[model samples]
Target: MPPATPPSPARRPGYGERRGELVQAAIRVVAAQGIAGLSHRSVAREAGVTHGLVRHHFGTMTSLIAEALDTILPQSLRRNPVSLLLADPGYPEEDLVSWIDEQADLQVFEYEVLLATRHTPELRPLAERLYRGYEDSVRSAFAEHDLPAPADAHVTLILAAIEGLVLHRVTFRRDDGPTITAAFVALREAIRLAVAADGAPST
Candidate 1:
């Protein structure tokens, strides 16, 4: 019987695939228990892999945290309403709300990391990159829609408002869908009006 075809070598995951799994596990651990709970063993347990395997993929916890942020930042941006609108102006608000609901854990993870930066100076750069990613996405969305480039302060305020809304929704746990959706809709309309007003010629 051809020696049972050598059992097909047990079909191990590709290197990149395994690394990705570890990163996702790290995010989940941080999301559930905050950054203080993240360790090689914790991630290994979360991913159902050996701790050595996690270390092999990421030499240190810092590396693992960085990779987790790197992986999640794009994911968060891609699902962001502003980014979605930039990609497809017709993207539904309902869909955005659904995506937000589904990604609550990811949002929690992000905030955990951002807060951790206060005590972990090494993480400050990663936090800066995270904010820069959001800022770039917002700037791109504004340009894509022909809105005037907002001042740096205005962009910062926009990010603060959106981030605050997301935090309130995820943290409170009781914020209803309609309320969250309405808040997002109002924020988007407000942004458009503000940008248009900035661009309009003085009467």
Candidate 2:
């Protein structure tokens, strides 16, 4: 018989769980009560952990807020998992609208954080970075469709249109109607045209 290898070292107890719990708890609080409601005690209570643990782990409320915002991406994906990145060949590029709809709650959570950032000088940089990430994803999806590289303004325009549609629907639409769907189709077509090279077929 081959020589047996030594066993792997045991993992630290509850290390990842504690941090993840606090971050998720923060997200739930923001999602349910808005960013204005987030506090050390609130998140601690949500996570069922000590207030000092939250402070000891994050050191400050802003740091905790940042972590919560950062977590939305992964949390959102898990709930409404995307099958492919825009970089993948044969990916259903048109399905982007549907995908965004599935992640609506996550988007709402992010928008709350963004609104909070305007009043928080320390939070602006991270929020800007987060938005740039959204832009990059948009650019990638555009690239996958063989669309030409859009200018920064064009990227911003597309992102603004899509996010606005989402926000408008979430804020106003209460019934199970295709209001957002109709708007998204028009927005998607507009984006396809915007990314097309001059004189390319608009179809």
Candidate 3:
């Protein structure tokens, strides 16, 4: 009988420094090429690594794209949306609205991913997972304020408005910030009223 060859070692990143570098490279690749532009070879070129290494680190383009979105997307929200929302226990209505307006105007990368999702069915699941994660994150923020369980419809609207604002901003170069702020302000008030009606004493 012929001798069997040993299997190749798995290609996951080593951890700590290298892993973060690999992820950041993937983010740039996504930013440049859109999610559809993500390929092991393309990402490897972007990261200045061997194609085999990129595959080893991320396994597949889908995983790489998902990770890219995961790492970069939240910071856009955390830096702008979440940070502003949490900054003041008494966050003025205008500050809250302006923050949302700013986020909607910035971060065109999300629009790229959303467009890619329409063509790549594999991406849809990852996109859904990411959206759900955002919804949960937003919900947790409201919960911290002793707010009621926010209605799913409102969350959906917020997500849609954000997406629409990005689309309008990128496609027509139009400003949708004020419109987005108006919608968000309405949702915020609804949440606050619901929280007050729930009668949970604010901590």
Candidate 4:
């Protein structure tokens, strides 16, 4: 008989992979039902695993939430139009709309967590840390472009404007890509104008 085929590699997910799946499931639950609806059972159901598995991976609700935030923070920054624009000044506004459309659920989940912070003081730290991550990315992007980084307040305003646009798009289910692209273009121009005005020689 032909030598037995090498034993099939273990098909089971590793510990870290299972934890990541649970975190993604948690995000989906929060995105669809808000943070109040998130429970180990809900996430386990979404992930096609048992609640016991979720608990084994995350140990506590707060820990799971925090882990979800940690996972999403980097994702948010990477997918954020501001970060994209900073990294590629010539990145098209139309692409911004496309990116938003593609990541609408993730954006919604981020907003849910942010809104939750209003009544859940304990979550404020995580939310603040998330914002700081964005701010830091903005600064780094500015530096990479050989531009002076805007003040923290300016950075905050810029990010807020982008977030507002994203909220509007996702909330309204706006499918008018051109209209959204125009808005993003306007925002991008406004940022450029602000930087230019700041750097201009004194009158």
Candidate 5:
């Protein structure tokens, strides 16, 4: 008889790093397949580990998805409004073009997440939280321009327009960055001017 081979040691790193990788893998899988297609086995396979590894780390599907959302949502926010605001903290009029570019890039990723969320319960809260944080940030950024503030509906509309533009560009057209940014810059400036002149959030 051939000599018995010893079992291989687990290649996974320490808890924190391994967990982070698993979460990231979950994001990729979700992006590619949507929530309906995700499973512990699939994510584990994507991460090059066993299904047991995913279960061991995440415990439940909901918990795992939530953690994944936590990781992804922040980046989504950063990609658009967050990064745009960060680039020009003093709100330089000349930098509006740059802000629009950043925002458009951010929207591409956001729409992907939104598509995934449609089928994943774990992603609902994540989406909600992202919207909340985004709205707050938009309000703050407008406030910085010596504006009163936008109502939730107005903020939602602006966000929707940015996202809708990205989705349309992705689905029906090519990379329309310059055109989209020009439109967004004009709209954002108009909003800022309106808010400033009104001296309060519009209802």
Candidate 6:
């Protein structure tokens, strides 16, 4: 008989640090393996923590996923689309696309968690609040550009469009630059036309 190998030492809890660490690890896990592969053990393995710590830090698995979204939402909204349309966020960054490329995992993880929110009722409110923040940025961005933005209902549609664009490209790993550029061009034109029709003064 072969000799029994010793088990690897159990990872120690991060205590307060585990909250943030686990959230980020969960994001990486989802990005690397997709949301379907996310599990307590998977996240623990990614986070280098014992599996029990996942349950300890986050009572429900869904809550951990929700927190991961919460963690990345602010980074996603760090600068409004208008800022990128004008110039990059400035200093310590190049542009939104650059930032997205740099944080590809986080960005991809964001959409995955977003899909999870669609079916997870308990996590939906957190998603809604996070979305409101993005919406606020969208409203502010257009307003700053003196552009007429969509109303709440229409804003939802626009957001869906933007989401689809990013999701499709990111999922396929396609570099359809012209198509993506044209989409933004169309969006800018629409905003400009709407503002013009509204007879709004330009900023």
lDDT for each residue of candidate 6 in 32-59, tens digit (9 for 90 to 100): 9988989899999998879997888887
Query: For model 5, what is the error of residue 181's alpha carbon versus the real structure, in angstroms, after optimal superposition?
Result: 2.6
Candidate 1 residue spans exceeding 4 A from truth: 1-7, 83-91
lDDT for position 121 in model 3: 88
How does each model score on lDDT?
0.81, 0.69, 0.62, 0.81, 0.64, 0.70
* Model 3, span 1-203: residue lDDT tens: 98898999888655666657777776666656666676778767877889887777778777766776676556656643432343345355455445444554224455666678888788888777777777887677666655566667766665565455445545554565566557555655554565455556657
Better of 1 and 4 by TM-score: 4
Better of 5 and 6 by lDDT: 6
Candidate 3: the clashing residue pairs are 11-56
Best by TM-score: 4
**Of 3 and 4, which scores higher on TM-score?**
4
Give every collision pair in model 6.
Answer: none
Candidates' TM-scores?
A: 0.88, 0.76, 0.64, 0.90, 0.68, 0.74
lDDT of 1 by residue, 50-164 (tens): 9998989988887887888888878887665675544445566667667777888889989998899999999999889878988987888788777787768768878887788
Model 2: residues with Cα > 4 Å off, grouped in runs? 1-13, 74-102, 198-203
Q: Candidate 3 at 20: error in angstroms? A: 2.5
Instruction: Return the candidate ranking by TM-score, descending.
Output: 4, 1, 2, 6, 5, 3
- Candidate 1: minimum summed lDDT over ten consecutive residues — where? 83-92
Give the higher-TM-score candidate: 2 or 3.
Answer: 2
Enumerate residue pairs that collide in model 5.
none
Q: Which 10 consecutive residues of model 6 have the lowest summed lDDT?
A: 86-95
- lDDT, model 4: 0.81
What local lDDT score does residue 88 receive in model 2, on the 0 to 100 scale?
A: 37
